[model samples]
Target: MKIYTRTGDTGETGLFGGPRVRKDVLRVEAYGTADECNSAIGVARAAGPDPMLDAVLAEVQNQLFVVGADLASPNDSPYIPRVSATMTAFLEEQIDAMETELAPLQQFILPGGTTVAAYLHLARTICRRAERVVVSLAAEEAINPELLPYLNRLSDFLFVAARIANARAGVDDVPWRKP
Candidate 1:
């Protein structure tokens, strides 16, 4: 198949269930940001050879695809896999497990450390953006109710993952300080 579909050349794209929307619409923005977060995680995975982090992030990357697809499809679309509470629970479990390996945070931290950790921090912010967009979308229409909680927990997971990466590398988190 040719890579160029040219269908979106006019600033519109089709949803999974035969609906067309402007490329700039909220749903598109939400899924696009989710895709961006997934790519950022991939970069973090490639930035270093941390097997545990890579394994966890690999699962997250796949889950993000489900997120993107859930956002891309209409609420009633039966073919798409909807985001679920179980997915969010998994992230919660991961965050709890990783947090146990590091010292408790007493102050705010900046988004920089080892390369892998730094990339994870970046992914965390992108995930936040995706979550915000999804929230906005949900306000206007019906969405998979579990999406918000999943994205919320996913960001928390990313934050702890970044810290774990830094800790495992013997790098300290860059703490925020008053100017």
Candidate 2:
């Protein structure tokens, strides 16, 4: 079987249970952004500083795939697994755990560190973009409401994870202050 479907030659794509829509459809954008975020997480994981962080990043990569799959399905599609509260809760737990090991945030921090931390920062930004795309999609379509919370919390988790990576690597978080 060849990988090229060539079905999208007309600038349209299919959802799991719905008629094909434009490739630029909101659903496609949302899932596409999720895909982008997943790749960013992979990059971060490759440059990850510690074993524990590497594990967590790996888990996040898996979870993002779940999210991407969830987005790929139509709202009425029963074939897709639901992204539940438990997933978002897990991210919250990770965020809390990472925060416990970091200094309190008093200012906006610049994105940089060991290569791992920088890639984490990159992931965080992409996560935010994914969240925004999901938001825009949800505004018009009946998306899984859980997606909003998941993306929202995921961004927060990425932010803290980046800090934790920098901290553990003995790297400083560059802070922003009024000039």
Best by TM-score: 1
Candidate 1 local Cα displacement, residue 41, angstroms: 0.4
Q: What C-alpha RMSD separates each model from the true structure?
A: 0.9, 1.3
Candidate 2 lDDT for residue 62: 88
For model 2 the TM-score comes to: 0.94
Give the range where candidate 2 is weakest over 10 consecutive residues by summed lDDT: 74-83
The alpha-carbon deviation from the true structure for residue 6 of candidate 1, after best TM-score superposition, in angstroms, is 0.8
- After superposing candidate 2 on the true structure, give the runs of residues whose Cα lies further than 4 Å from its correct spot: none
Find the 10 residues in a row with the least total lDDT in model 1. Answer: 74-83
Candidate 2, residue 16: the lDDT equals 79
- Give the per-residue lDDT digits (tens) of candidate 2, residues 75-154: 66667777889999999999999999998988898888678878888888888888888888888878788998999999
- The lDDT leader among the candidates is 1
Cα lDDT for residue 57, model 2? 85
Clashes (N, CA, C under 3 Å) per candidate = 0, 0
